[model samples]
Target: MSEVRLYSKADFSECRLTNHPLYSYIQVFFSQELSELVENSTNGTCYALEVGQKLCLVVVAQFQEGQTYPTSLRAQYLDYAQEELALTGIKGKRLLSGAFQLLKRIVPKTIDEVVYVGNYLLSTNLFQPFTTEELQKIEALLQRRFPTKTIVYRSQNSCLNQQLMENLSALNYQSFISRQVFIAHQSQVIQQKKTFKKDRKLAKDTTFNIRTNFDVTNYSERIIELYTQLYISKYSQINPRYTPAFIEAMKTVQNTSFTGVFDEENLIGVTMSWELDGTLTVPILGYDLSYPKESGIYRLLTYYTLLRVNDEQLFHMSSGVGPFKLSRGAEYFPEYIYYKRPASAKERRLSFWLLQKVNTILTRMSNKRAY
Candidate 1:
């Protein structure tokens, strides 16, 4: 049996697991450079955990004691209440606002100190297999190190992470569907979805050029600007407020590929993606909201992504635009957040339990309405 060694930003460079199979993952995700970037952009503090020599996990500690909702987990998990209620008209808006206020008073306060295992601040989390004994050791170590903080493991549907989710469940972690993610099999989409065919045609006819040969370091600022325009300014400030430094840092990350959508000399769209186990996930994507909708830049970007997914690969499109994705033959599945609190932390545990029940009811209602 090997020991679980934890590394904080202060001593992360001292981690001696150089010969680990996933050493490249450590360089990209757990490096000091990326840790600084994440801490600067979000409310979480990043850490690394080495479980013997076989596994290395990215750990994020979110201490949102006095943080605003935009920078906290509350925004990611519960802010959808506002969007969902808007569909119900004025009365629903008012009622939901009041209910949200009540929840804000109770929910966010209880989740102040949380430790997220394997959180990369992305919509989807990928996992590597380890024995139940390894998981137990990791859990015990986290519990001992942060006794009062709740522990969370976030991952996609059971289809992708069944064994890991089951392991967490057996360890008494309560699971909740955080959001629904969309997945499209490339060959299926190309062959069966007419909308995909139309999108591909539109991409082919469009004047904008999708370039993968540009230097990421040189376009870092523009990438951040375009990303902020769509993800933060237009959508929600709750999205990670990534800076140019983060974009520039991508030059050192070997796994991720960045592509730019250009209209002649102007860059109008950007996407960052990585593939693992024949599954491609685009974690960073943004387009110029100011561009004319008729220009079909967004469509071109999506088409380009689909082209990357060959017959052997599946594309995980994260969450949002349910109807658009579904129309293009994408299947939907629930992404989950699994959590556990210390037995001595009664109040926090009770709060999370109540939250879990509420989330379960809401998810069921949403599913019923969707179908």
Candidate 2:
């Protein structure tokens, strides 16, 4: 029952939950590229408290620069807020809290680089614990220290910190995840083990194929195309998400392990994955929108997860609102989007102002863009 403190990244390996399956899950979810961004930008002053040998309390933060955003003159802000406000209080709270926490941590240091910060956590098997008030207190401590910076605390309907959103708002702080949707596995991923095994065989038997290795030759364009199709089918009606440059960057990350299923030479499905710190993450996957029967893409990808599951890692499927994954037996891992900061006055002043400006600009921005 001893709580081992992780005050530095060097202490990561020794921390108990670092060895857990779910720990690997969150690591994999952010992917190596995203993780490295956090890694390269992080200030090791970050800390965590490990409970027993399973659950961990992690705090990730970075100091960075200003971000460049394209101006949207034709964009309308009214309709956007109307819809955003139309969402239930539960959802609005989850998104804002998560984003706010990240902003709060990195605000003071982000004088030069546009950085996103907060706690990225891994809860040990069956022993996760953290309350909403605890998270807000962390945010308050940051605000007390740095009053001018614009910091946001963000999270979504996280079961672990259910009371967070209301508590933060009650304190007069605004929160948002902005443009994001979250989906979790409702059932267990193990039940689909049989189906996953069968799909791999099906992919191999016919021209319908799947690969364990990442061959980045003609693949970049393929990655771009399929991802674009996914955007068109899934998100185009509502919002324009994933720019061409962002899609192109997917092919450049290291330790990338991607699996693709083909329908007689046509790349029907592709899952862009990465393995790191013993975790595997699928941040992007796409298939023919019309191929409903082949939704087995997820099942096959889970089957592909067998490659690393035995290596003591949890396959992180990343964030999405998709519900189909719940039926596949992937366990739901609840986590909070905590708002915390370093103790300092210069930091506090800078943080408060930054949050206000960004929130104002974002609030004024429209949801839909022609470009």
Candidate 3:
């Protein structure tokens, strides 16, 4: 018999599944302190789910109008929509713009209420698989709990979660490509890619210092500042606005590591990565962009991270920088979001069907582009 348990913020510490195999990994995101910190910073409310002995986190987010980044469906979908348009050509953008203007009001509000299963508040979500029977029960539980919200499972790629994706599809969840992500084996890149070698040498010979021993708790503010500078100010404000409290909580998490890049004692770059099941995923990475492009700050940060991956481990570099990641022997694949809506919500079903159609076109366009 499979058992499912849900823990809210107030009672998370009471969960008895601490002895579970993935508890250490779960603690990185779902520990009571960390969960509270994340909720305080973002629009998300966190919960812990335990099925049998496997554990994962869930975030129920109510996106407000004009919400920035991934917190809002409009922001998340638009970012990928723009990328797809860019790859196809300007003509596609003009056509899509008019269509978007026509549907903008209806689409955004329809996708606003979301229940993110396995949402770790990171670029990628690492999941411990649930059996089909277990998942069916879990799905029913979520539908009952969040009757009006769209249930979503994100950051799923076939390479990493083929069985899980199959299970979701079997349960009648709709899936669409969210974005292109890169996955590479460290040793193969080190041996085959000349560009990777050059970047490694550049990082090794650079005047800036790399420090893994620095106390992240002490520099939480600086870390958030650098992260905001790149992820929000330069890229898009739609990205999750993580706070210093979130960084400070990371200091005590096991199986996670933080690295800082410094130029003459000033913190210029920082990355926080965690390893699970022989895969290293760097969900938090940022650096000062005020320096000239010739300064090679970004290159140095990328190479330094590559060096941290073990020879046998795979690196899951989250979306964007397609050309840069591809040049270093990373293979690109589409990451997907699997979702389902309540049967009674006819309008939401229609909205999601429309979204599926739009995503299908975008996926086809993205697939045609050379990496």
Question: Highest TM-score, which number?
Answer: 3
Maximum-lDDT candidate: 3
- Clash pairs detected, candidate 1: none
Order the candidates by TM-score, highest first: 3, 1, 2
Per-prediction RMSD in angstroms? 3.2, 10.9, 2.8
Tell how far residue 55 is off in model 3, in angstroms. 0.7
Per-residue lDDT of candidate 2, residues 1-371 (tens digit):
24333334444555556555345433432343333322222232333444344343333333322211101100111122233334424334455545555564655443321112233321111123334455444455445444543333433334323455556556554453233322323223543456445755754654456765545456656765676576445543222233334444445445555677776667767776655445455655666666775456555655565445542565555434334333334444332222322333254665567565545544343222100
Candidate 1: misplaced stretches above 4 Å? Answer: 1-3, 10-42, 52-57, 60-62, 65-71, 80-97, 108-110, 348-353, 369-371
Give each model a TM-score.
Answer: 0.87, 0.45, 0.90
Give the per-residue lDDT digits (tens) of candidate 3, residues 35-75. 25543235566788888777888877786654544455666
On TM-score, the stronger of 2 and 3 is: 3
Instruction: List model 1 lDDT by residue over 1-371, tens digit each.
Output: 97787887677778887655445555655554543554333456667788777545555556453332323456655565455455443333475466556666677454646777776666566666656788899889888888887888776476677788788888888887666777887565565678888887897788888899898888888888888788667766556666676676665555678889998878899998866667888877888888888888777778888876677787888777777777877777777887887666656554566666667765775565331
Candidate 3 RMSD to the real structure: 2.8
**Lowest-sum lDDT 10-residue window in model 2:** 67-76
